[model samples]
Target chain A: MHKKHNFGAGPCILPSSVMEQAAQAVINWGGMGLSILEVSHRSPEFEDVVLKTQLLVRELLSVPDHYSVLFLQGGASTQFAMVPMNFLSAGKKAAYLDTGYFAQKAIKEAKLFGEVELVASSKDKDYAYIPVGFNNDKHAAYLHCTSNNTIEGTEIFDFSTAGAPLICDMSSDIFSRKINITDFDLIYAGAQKNMGPAGMTLVIAKNEFLDQAKKEIPSMLDYRVFRDNMSMYNTPPVFSIYVAMLNLLWLKDQGGVSGIEQRNIEKAKLLYAEIDRNPLFYGTADVEHRSRMNVTFLAINKEVETGFLKFAADMGIVGIKGYRTVGGFRASLYNALPLSSVEVLVNAMASFEKIYSDKTVLELE
Target chain B: MHKKHNFGAGPCILPSSVMEQAAQAVINWGGMGLSILEVSHRSPEFEDVVLKTQLLVRELLSVPDHYSVLFLQGGASTQFAMVPMNFLSAGKKAAYLDTGYFAQKAIKEAKLFGEVELVASSKDKDYAYIPVGFNNDKHAAYLHCTSNNTIEGTEIFDFSTAGAPLICDMSSDIFSRKINITDFDLIYAGAQKNMGPAGMTLVIAKNEFLDQAKKEIPSMLDYRVFRDNMSMYNTPPVFSIYVAMLNLLWLKDQGGVSGIEQRNIEKAKLLYAEIDRNPLFYGTADVEHRSRMNVTFLAINKEVETGFLKFAADMGIVGIKGYRTVGGFRASLYNALPLSSVEVLVNAMASFEKIYSDKTVLELE
Candidate 1:
């Protein structure tokens, strides 16, 4: 089989070495003569897997002892509801940034629980860039923001809490970059993009912040329940967490988040440069706010857009299609996506450009 | 390597063929040249998987068109909250049958959203049997019950709604026996038992019943959202669902639920017969209400109990430990567990009984 370059967004690529090991573990985990799928979550072997994965997340992110790392299910979408259920009561207000599609979703769920004050919004500009210099309610229960917009191909490079507890949905760009854990009271990411697969959501939150959460909330939605029980309040997504541990081990060998960030930067720079030089194509989203993880771009016309997609597919370049709302192409350069895959995508663009340029000259004649 | 017999209560055994296919798909799914772990949930390939799995569930169970089958996250624990959040309001009372540990848990979450009336309970007898001959409130919003008590080793053989809609938590005994889908307004099972892995939950509910659910609930917790979106409101648990589809396929090959039910009966009879005949042990739950899925038993004495467990372990029979609250032994016979494995467990029991009987005679001498 030929090497296929995968760039799917969320449920995205993972290291080949990790995939190999994960496959083997599914068959016989730790030589226990049992498939990981069939192993009891309460078993010491799986418990160690959960513990080791949490430790790896802590070591990789430099998480403080004051914070708890939980591997929960229901993805970040569940976190959208859980964040409010835990902190915001009917009387209190929560501040949220309306930067893109996901941020708007977080705001929608928060509204179900309490008052939501929009701190800043880039919705007016189609979420092309992050908003700046907006004041947040210091007295609000918490200030929520999305660190990266998977759909709009924009990222938040800077964060401000404005005296409120900071909660960020870092779903798309979690392990792709480095950030200080102390700056935010809570951080969550669905483990598909940079972490592992789609079944688990990773949560890192301050223990003190959790203490103030409203009492008598649904236990499954309560972060305190998960924190107290070590995320074993129920049978967790065992295989997903196991695979995530393998991927995290791979990330650590590649020198952790800081190391992967450098490579991600290089890959993004290469792809964006080609988009700039290619006459047949133009990059979407503001250049200043362009995502290093998901690079959104468009062909000059609809004909070229259809033509180039087919041209690229023939070369085994898959999962570069953009989001539905944004009708162009999105090449997701998540952490596991190698520079070589980006080079293949860039070459596909260059070759398509040359063909289009010749056709345009002929049509002009 | 020896063939190990797995009798885990849940997250137990899966077909060996299903595990093999699942492991291969993790590396290269359907020869798509990409790991199933890395594929987009929106892609045609994965959409087909979700569709096919739904179809298999519908076909295997003969699900009616008025019902929707959903593959969701958060397990049945989440369903415990969602059931009341959707149907039960603060003023409305929901009737509950407190059968065992999991039934109590479901009742606890429901109380958070509305008033709960305990129609009947077996807790007075340490939940050794399912409650009987109790009348539920006909005017209650819904009647809730657990079909199987995983911890206490009891299963409900008969269901009655008392004119209200019926909802069941069938997490541990979902596919092990045939049940009329039309009998309940809703049925839910965490996939770890008879279905698949731990990351996904399977929900089957009547569309008409869901239409009456409360409006403006959090989208993720709303069954209507999953039904409308075909369980794709967000990225589903890809690998878990894939493995489930494989296991469901294996189940279909074994002649669907009715066929497996016969084998399950044989397996249960073999083990329960051994427990009844053996002088060193006695069954835990009431004889009539004893679960075919989980057969709980205890040794006559503590020293003999410890010795028998070690003896079973040495013979490569695993996951037979009972629940903490009900200390003894529990050999779970899920759908995928073969009768051959049960024979090994029975042989181990017989061999230990012989040794214990000889030791008793020697002590008397």
Candidate 2:
């Protein structure tokens, strides 16, 4: 029953305890003798789930009182359209910074809502770092960024501060690090990455940003609709939220965000150091803006990448294959991934180098 | 443990066998040594899950080649918006028949995208039946209907044709019946109900309707994105899809839609007949429009309702409580619910009636 340190991207590894608790709830939830999935979302049992999740999120992230936390259905992918649809009424254009594949998707979704100006993009350099030279467009309704690029293994170390109600798709990095809530009026993440699982998108939006929801907004898509209903407008993925609640509870038990921040820093440091110290492996992301959650690397020789991946897979390791959006290895170290797992991954890498080198030595001998 | 037959609403009952399969997959999926949740959705193993689910759905429902099946996150609630955003273009109005709460929510969402007309509504009778007076708006985008009203226990026995492209929200009663896919251009159901669990929404749309997707639609929300990527535009809810797959497989093994429809018809009949036989309880909804999915009723004496519910709960009956939107008792008989469970409910009802009658006779004496 030992869960392999699961590193699959989104719908990714959850804490063992959270999974166990979630599994139990699926059977006899809160002693109600009903699966959490079958409970009325409006019932006090579920309402408590909604309220406690919001309160815990606020407490963990230090969210301001006015900011609303919505437990939405679609992952951040849905928010890509929603952000502009609800917020794009004021202006004809919105500023978009494409840091990675997901940011590009958000930009594409935003354009459907309004005219999009590409203020900056790192696609020119294969999305290895936060794009530079962002010229602010004051007329733009909001500025958008993806805090952590899951595919490209890069991140925005510090958010751009030109500040037109900064909107960020923090799908991969929220709850992974501490953030100043005041800097961004709207920040959202698909719960899968660091929070819990797929199908739940966690959003924290300022009250002002929400008041901008156009009158004809789709009642279900309307963030305000969720705000009014406390995200129970219609059955809001009860089991997902239930599991997410357990994850948030697990996060709190793990000493909240700050405690994990220190551990994640060390996990990232150890992996990156091994990648850098070894000549057989190559790190992809820019040194200044590497991600703490996913480590991107490649075998120095591309011909053996498949063999190396296979070798890693044979050794109780899985889901480390890089996103096809970027071809290489991506070791996603989310909150539940202990430093021990990172050591396991790093150990495999060192052994990989030794095995390949010794094979060549044996041939020469 | 003894898992009660969960019958709340959508996210209702899942087959115990399916739940057992899900429990097994949580640890080792497809002999992959990783939890199904930990598999890369982009990988071939999970792709089999995504593609095979569509195949099973097509086989089970007899979906045509002209139709495309998609597994998308964001639930049916998100579909309310996507349906309009995509189809309601070209200055055409969309006609939505509001049968109940979710239908009303969908109507409100349609207005956000473009012109929307309330073609029919049951609100006059508190959504007791599918509304009357269908109009053929020659220029309308689609005529939308909630095939089954989960909260009100009302349903359209078959698809309604209003001389426009038909869109149906079959969230609560999709797989329970044999659906004519050609009658509706688009059909969506959140997997919680008869489909499987929560998080995933099953979208079956005609290829022709999808071909008409207007440009500038958010890539993620765009049916075309899912159509093109085969529902992997982003990481799908792998675990949810896997569960749905198992549920569908189980459905097929039990003789597919025809078999399930027969069983469901019988279960609804037996329970409704029992309710009608008893003077103490009368069924909700117009008899002609009653739903086979959720059977709702009220006691002649309001005082007896809670007692009945508590008494039922004590007998391992879960999700018997009606939606607070319309309180009484609702026995949801999704496809996963066995006819034996309905018998369990009927026997409990008879026992409750007997116990209450004896107590009343004692008091009178």
Candidate 3:
């Protein structure tokens, strides 16, 4: 069977090799004669999986020893609540950037715990670009921002925290790029996009920062509990973590995050150039703030939009439909999405443009 | 490779058939040329998966129309906090039966939300039996109970609610038996044991009871939000739910819950009988309260105990080690554990007993 070009936004693509190995492990992990699904989390085999996965995250990111890396459930949505539940003590305020859909969500959950100051917002421009130079409260409990907006196809390349401790939801773009781990106190990502799959969230937080989190909160929500217990305070999403370990191993083989980031940049640049040069389509999001992961674009009209989607589907191009809130096409160039797939999508675009342009000229004559 | 008997307490065995299908889907789901891990949770294909999974649970359990079946993340440990965060209101006491380790953890989370009335406990006997006939507060907001203690090797065969709204954590014994859906206001289980795998939690709650839950809780912890959104509040654990659907289909093929309950009983009976008849072994939990899912037993002495464990390991019988708090052996008979596996365990026990007893005779002589 021909490989379909997958461009799903969050539960996006993964290396075929990772998928093959993951599938095999589900049947017989490490030749144990027992499926990974059936293995006890406490067993030495699974404990090693957890340990190696943590080591990979740390080694790949150059994470400091002071930071605790955790594989927890409930995705980034749970972290929205947990962030404030842990750090935002009663009567204290937390500063937030209103970047896009997820940023707004993080702010909403924080309000349930304490005060939230919206230090900056791009909602005024339909979240088309990232905001800059906004005044932030250094004295606030901590500053929170979504480093990448999966829905709006915007990413923050430049971060300025204004002296406050930084917490970022990097769900859509984590592991696709390299960043200074010391720049933020906490960094979290749901492992669906560039890491592995859904069902697990990766958290890296400074131990001192974790110690400042509120006491008496639910143990499951406590960052310190996971940190202290090596993220095994409870039964983890075992298979998800294992697959993530495989995917990360693949990343390490490709020369780690820095290597993958170059490929990601090339794929994004190739697609964005086609979107700009093609007369039949236009790119969404400001060029400066556009995401290297999710490339949102639009056809000149609805007729062409619907036709192009069907046209792409016929070529085994799937999961390119844009999120409902942002109507149009979103070709996600996640880490696992090959440059070859991007070329196929770009070629499809150029061919459709030629056909449509010729048809329009003939009608005018 | 020889098949190993998997009897790990939780994250236990699944049918080999289910594992095969789950593995295939990970490589190429439904001939889509995309791994299930790479598919969008919002895609129609996966939407159908979530819907069918819910339908299967409803159909298999004969769940009433008033109950909403939801698939959520964070396992049962998260449910411990969510249960009280949603139900236990300020100034209202919630009654709890302290059955074992998990039960105590649930009680701890509940105390963070409101007053917790310890309705009953078997701690006096090291959790060797299920407590019975203890006075309960009917005026409490809700009554919480763990139906099966995975670590204690005790199961509650009967339940009395004392007129309070009933909530049960059936993490270890949910699909192992058939129960009246109307007996409780809410029922929850982590999918690892009898359903599918870890990472997903199955929640079936009466809609009316959900309405009484506290407002202003975090959306992830709010049962009503999940009920309203069809459990897609935020990209539900896609792969876990898909595998669970496959496993549930396997259960349906095996004549559903009641059918599996009989086989589970037979497997439990076979192992427990051997534990009783063997001169070198004795069952740990009270005879009447012994768990059909996990049969906990002790050996005649430390030497024989160490010897039997090694003896069983050589035969590829695995995951039968008992909890440290109650050590000897714990042969968990979850639904997926075939009677053949149980026979091997029983035979091992009898063989070990014969060898040890003969040694004892020779030593005495």
Candidate 4:
């Protein structure tokens, strides 16, 4: 097999070991002679799986006893509507921080339920920096923010809720960092990035906050329904949740979030350091707010960018293409992305610079 | 490994060959050196899988070109809210047939959107039979029904939508039989039963009916959004869809829906014949409305029922316990249940009757 480096943004890489175990379970689980996919979700075997999965999420996040960790469907896009549907009732306004594409998407969905207040926005500078500070509405339904911007590669480390309850979409950067679970009322993440696969969306909501859900919300869209039923209100994404459970086990083995966070920091440092020192490349996001998870940068010009991408592919490194809106390379260094992969990318960048760096290289043409 | 027979109502049995191939893809897809779960949905590999899956569904059911087939997240329960949210605006009514638990749940959600009319119901008999010969409102937004009742073991073979458009939740008996595509405006099914696994839901909607969707629906909940994007409007249930694709391929190899339906008929006939002939057990569903998918029945007493359950378990049969509300046995013989499995169940029932046929059998203690 070729040595491949997967840097795809969302449905990204997972630990190789986790993939192996998940594949095994896909064939036969618990020696029960049934694939995990073939077992009934209500059966004792699967119940153990769902319970173990939830327990792991709570343990990894150090989630409070009053909070419910739910494995749900519809991805973060569904939560974009569910959050506002549950919290932003008629006549209530939700305070939102418009950081990037996802935050803007959330804001649009929130607008459907009631009034929405844009507390702050980084759109003025193409979302290259996370807005430093904002005054939130203390009486608003809740304050919502996307903790990390995948496309722009910016992150907000500070999420001081002040007097208002906080709701966060940490889809891309969750589990790669540590945070106080008590600080937020609601947190949701699509599992493809840091958690597991594409189908399962994890929702951790404080119980009291869930009790405040608007009456008459559709049962499927209501957080209370999912939390009350232990995320079994309907048939869940079984394979996705099982895979996520394996990933959580892998996370715990890797010294939990703190241990992975340290490795992530080291990985980001190695890649960003190479970008800073390389003459042909320059970081895109603001240095202070650059996302450690997704490192976005440019390659001087289109010719250099195209040449480097082809070069990376030739070396069996793939999915390093830049976002459509932003014409620069983006290497998503997610939790499962090994430090060795980052070293390879950095070495590729250095080699490209060594061959192309010259005072009159373009003039020679 | 222990021999096991899975009769789960949903997340039920799939063809052995389909499960084998799906298990392989979970490890490495098409020798791409990436687990199907690890690849991006936008990748060419996953795109081909999704395309082939859709084509198979269309070909199996002979779906019209005007109808768009979608593989979405959130299951059929999400569609409960989405269907009415899109079709039933204020001042309009959606006529519903309350046949069982799911139909009631759908009605409850539709009530949140607009007026809901109970066109017919078998709830008086605890949904033990399908409601037949219902009058429908031609001017209503739509008429909705569940094609098969799993808990009650009833089915409606003739939908006959009248002049109004029909929406069906075919969660349990979707591919187990053949149907006319033009008879319904929309059809949705949770993949746990006859399709593949939990998490993914299939939606087939006529283009004109989709054009009538209400404006301002949440992007994730709107069918038009999924249809327009070819079910890639969001990160779908990738693993479940892939598995369902394999199951669909298996169905085609068995000669599509008509072939499977013939085997389904034979399987149900064998089981029902034993039920009918056995003096110690009896079927719950009315003969006229008996389902070919789920065969529900009961022993003469709780003692006999308990004894037979243990006997079935020892004989490698599982998930045959009846729903709590109904209580004795519900052998869900879905599309993948082999005729030999039905023969096994029939022999078990015969042996059970032979052992407990006498009136003094319970009194012998």
Better of 2 and 3 by lDDT: 3
Better of 1 and 2 by DockQ: 1
Q: Compose the digit string of candidate 1's lDDT tens values, residues B242-356.
A: 9999999999999999999999999999999999999888998999999999999999999888998899999888999888889999999999888889999999899998899
Candidate 3 Cα outliers beyond 4 Å, as residue runs: none
**How much does each candidate deviate from the true structure in C-alpha RMSD?**
1.0, 2.5, 1.0, 1.7
Model 3, range A108-223, lDDT digits (tens) per residue?
A: 99999999999989999989899999777778899999998988989999875566799999999999999888989999999999888899999999988998989898999998
Candidate 2's C-alpha runs over 4 A off are A1-5, A90-92, A132-139, A160-162, A362-365, B122-124, B131-139, B158-162
Least accurate 10 contiguous residues by lDDT in model 4 chain A = A354-363
lDDT of 1 at A266: 99
Per-residue lDDT of candidate 3, residues B36-83 (tens digit): 989999889999999999999999999999999999998899999999
For model 3 the TM-score comes to: 0.99
Instruction: lDDT winner between 3 and 4, please give it.
Output: 3
Residue B57, candidate 2: Cα error in Å is: 0.6
Q: Report the lDDT tens digits of candidate 1 across residue range A97-214.
A: 8989999889999999989999899988899999988887678999999998888999888874557899999999998888999999999999988888899999999999989999
**Candidate 2: TM of chain A?**
0.97
What is the per-residue lDDT of model 4 for residues A202-289, given as tens digits with 9 covering 90 to 100? 9999999999988998988888888889899988888889889999999999999999999999999999899899878899899999
